[model samples]
Target: MTTTSEHTQSVATATPSRMLRYLPASALLIDAALMTLVGLVAIVGRRELDVFASSAQVEDQLVLAGPLMIVGWIATVALLGGYRRDVFGVGTDEYRRVLNASLLAAGVTGVVCYLARFDLSRGFFLLAYGLGVPSLILGRMALRRALHSARRRGLLRHRVLIAGSRAHIDEIARVLGREPWLGYEVIGALTPEYDLSEETATGVPVVGNADEATSLAKAYNADSIFFAGGAVGSSSQFRRAIWELEHESIQVVIAPSVTDISNERINIRPVGGLPLMHIEPPTWSDASRWGKRLFDLAGSLFLVLVFSPLFAFAALSVKLHDRGPVLFRQERIGKDGGRFACLKFRTMVVDAEARLNSLHEASGHSEGLFKMKDDPRITVPGRWLRRFSIDELPQLFNVVRGDMSLVGPRPPLLREVESYDVDTTRRLHVRPGMTGLWQVSGRSDLTWDEAIRLDLYYVDNWSMLQDISILTKTLGAVVSSRGAY
Candidate 1:
């Protein structure tokens, strides 16, 4: 006979509140309505151009298209997990899924139109696709901001229970603290060996042990239980805790030991009855090197061509403002401790280096790196240029010169490298990047440890996809202008 614990129900399994149920439905309705409106507008816009004129444009065909588009919108949302309650106010994942669904829907519509021999205007379809993608993402972003406002106002919040030792639970608490927009308030924690003196991490009460955790959850009405990485005594202890909590209908989230692992590198497979994790390291070989180099060269050339006007404008502005050289070249440590001339549009006074000696004490010495948050030597135009990263555009020339890759760790100053311990020296293994993990994340706001961790993580998990992601994020980072001196 199966034990009572083994036959128990799931936690957070209770029916969602009426408000919770309605919110997602409301979001889906809004999504569908926006898609239909955008699609109709696109169709009208296309018909104005001669490329979309057809015989059916008079009346009957126009009337029939509305219902078909609505149906398509609904189907797209369903396929894309739009109405899913969980992802409603979450991160970009929900929006990404919706965008993918729209693309798929557009593809299917194309195929069906082709198969049915219906004369659909290609221009109209393209307009709809173009509008639908941005509309979906923008709509979601707007909704997310609204939902975040509601959460801050204390309206739609999730009460959570965390399980594990103090150290593990503390990590979970800090993560939750960083994502208050997610609206998860820790109700309590469950630990096998409870210590009252150190009972709570992040001020959430330590309620009970594994056996009594279910009652504590019920009392707190927690939406879910987060299992932080820790031993659960025995297999039976783990099984028993899960069984007891299941009857209360709670969703259980097991936090794995893995952190800072790139999404591209991890794949899960089922082996017999157990789940196996497969981690494929980033491709870094002779062929990969060649491909990456080729990609960097081609992309740098394309960007240089496209942004030629902006580049010229920046150079002109610098020249007009100051009587010095437009380009700034510094000897910085590159890959494998090689020194390269890192180029930038000069943003500081020519005497900036000369004045550095007087300001050296102002730049604090921490981990052998000195940083001056407010250097007096920065020229007026230089301040604005550095803030928006306009000064860094000239790095494209460095990429062309084979001295730098488009993406990698930030180049360390020669003085900075001299101060590195054995571990920090690992960053020199790869070519220094124009913008990187730390630059996109926090830049100067990051402490030395966090900065090193980001660099090490990049070195450990570097990939073409990851590089692309960093480059994309760098665009936003430049716009935000955070942590720039």
Candidate 2:
């Protein structure tokens, strides 16, 4: 059905389409080039060459060493699997690899130079390491943003064909649809014995049965095949299917039945020729807890000092608005069900609590948690303060006093805590936060279940990186004032 000229034209058109797959690799190469330029600038600015016998001699030596350093760095990154397809365009793993590779490159270069008796400027090397790593990270982050934007526009996504039962396919499809930044474009699904009219929950059409996955994947030009829980007939069948997919260079992702488990906690081990997944219990180690406390203390104290002027202004405004106390302190449940005085700027009338019973019917959040979009009790200054979350600034003092953290689950009122079931009480395992997954995600707009899920996710997967990400996102959340009444 194909003619020579037509086939050539089609090939030409397909060239650029194939090139898109290498975009991440190209970005990495560009990063390497930029890093090399930074190193060159550092070398020149430090007059690294002048430190040697003669400028000409040193220049000649540098001409050889400079390219070697760049090549070495790039090679180190490649060796560390920084250019792997899976690590690209998502997660902190790529950035971590880059940092590790850079450090290793620097150390290796230093050792090589010393052993070879080559005179090099220590300051220049130090400057290169300091500037290169951060600059590379920032560059990669910018590239990641660009990739995410492209993905949002329905570009640069992996063509995925889900192979599973109807329920399993639907579940994976829903998750993939929600997280577009993950870059999986579900073309269709190959379920086990699906009817011709069947479609996934997210409207992905059923193309074929599970046994026909490979043929369907090829027909659709799928880049990956996702196997949800109970997708294949048996373990042997699943293993064979994975081998076949790998042979065809298609990625295979297995979504085990385990839900809400962080990757860091899961380890794949082989025992007696069987691949077993070992899940580590959530970290409640003293070292981790102490580290969190130190971070909270340092971060909260710094924030308090930085916002002291705003604090003074807020206090004055509240005092001027009403002849009542500026600080509003309420008893809230904290870690291990302990009670603490949670402080905020007085946002409502002094007798606001006295009218709570009268407004309960109208509040709409009558089921344990209380949230009203518009309350008549709020003062004018308090409304503005709450809108930008300035009222919560007082909680930084709580953080400094060891009652809270910079990031964790939201602190619950004593009444709300009283209604919490056994599972919900797990939130009290760690200190509450000034800003948390709940605060940055949706704040007051989130339903109770959504809020609980996010809080549980944070508790299960608490890390310094996750905390930093939440804090960074909190600034945007505050600025937008979405769901902040």
Candidate 3:
């Protein structure tokens, strides 16, 4: 019933919306405002607020210098690519640039003051930067949160055209699909010249052949083009394709066949005209060392102390609900096949474990994962506890005892561990976590295989930064309760 012209128009309209133009302008305005506010706060803290008055006869030269510093700081951020559209969302590159810019601006200001004999207050300088840098980073984080929320609602996503073999195209598409916050919307696939198909195995629509990547990309009004593995036969052809797309505003991303590798593990090197990808070996060994353990212990200790009141309340609630035990302890497999008693606030009836087999048989997935939504066994208070993950708070004790980490693979039950394949067994390299990639990703909503995949990926690519990021994302995930019981 639909004509080709109407279809084409609808498809083309999938390109970026007004958010494409608003994001950069918003970042600039926010940065300027934040820096100005920090400068004012610094001035007031140092009792140099009089510098703003025209009649103030201050020898500190704070009047002209303060405004110049704020302006220069903002300019420095823009000069260092902080305002670029590419760094606007989804990574720490923007925050890192802002930090670098702040440092550069401060150094220049110090140098200029010394060379010109301008009396700049040292206290004000330290106070301003110390507050300003963090404030700017927080501002960017808040803006990024807004961008992520919009993308999750299917707004402002990049229209990505993937050019590759079917298998590689699907792989890239899967990753992009999993992380909606990354905002890559796959418009269609550009297959290798040999095979012409209407769609991929995963049902991603096929638009054209690989050789016509540039043309098809433009036709779709793609915001980005991903050249997945096998898009071209040789280096020269790849180079030609890149050159063809240079005139368009479309971003070109080369997606290697590899999956589940973090950016930290991948290093691109220029080797005699070729970009050689160097992959660092897994960080699991290093992560299992004392540094991470020390952090886990201290962090858990702090959490336990701070949440003592909440802990008491949870315990009391469990006790009052049906007079059941306050704590539920289950033996779980931990690092390198070791067993530990994982703890949680009791959120189910006393005989809940006895009902598992029947539920499993009824659900038909009787072997690997055992989850039942609206589970009748969960107490009324238990539902609320599970929804917000207050039940998992007792895992801090497991962390204290060194059986778990603040961030690592999910702790598996004895039965679950029995079924793990060789690849999945690698998750034992580090201790299990109170919260992990699996916990924050989808929790009970994830497929058994998907949960294992995320756990294995965490085991093989562990880093303190990755751990910290997962921990931060965990807060948002808990607040949203995306995939809780």
TM-score of each: 0.79, 0.84, 0.90
**What lDDT does the true structure give each of the candidates?**
0.75, 0.80, 0.86
Per-residue lDDT over 94-202 for candidate 3, one digit per residue giving the tens place of the 0 to 100 score: 9999999999998999899899977677767778898998999999999999999989999888888899899999999999998899988888888887887778898
Q: Could you give me the TM-score of model 3 versus the true structure?
A: 0.90
Ranking by TM-score: 3, 2, 1
In terms of lDDT, model 1 sits at: 0.75
The better-scoring model by TM-score among 1 and 2 is 2
lDDT of 2 by residue, 1-485 (tens): 85434533342233122435687678667777888788778867667444334333335566888889888988898899878877878767999999999899999999999999887766567777888888888888887898888888877888787887777787788777867977887777777763454566666677778877777677667778888865788888887787767668677888766766778888999999888999988753331377888888888888889999999999999999978999999998988989999999999999999998888966545665677878899999999999999999999989888888888889999888888888888788888888888888789988888788788877777778889999999999999998899
Could you report the Cα RMSD, in angstroms, for every candidate shown? 6.8, 5.8, 3.2
Error of 3 at 459 (Å): 0.8
Residues 1-485, model 1: lDDT tens digits: 64322322232344322355577777777778787787777777776765755665522444665568667867787777877878878755688788788878888888988898876667667777789778877887887788888877755767777888777887888777755777776656777664543355455556667556667777656777888766276657777888887777677777666766666678989887566878876433321287778988998999899889989888888899877999988899988899988899888889777876667655545453445677777778888888998889889989888778888878888988998889888788777778889899888877787888788778778888778999999989989988887
Number of the top candidate by TM-score? Answer: 3
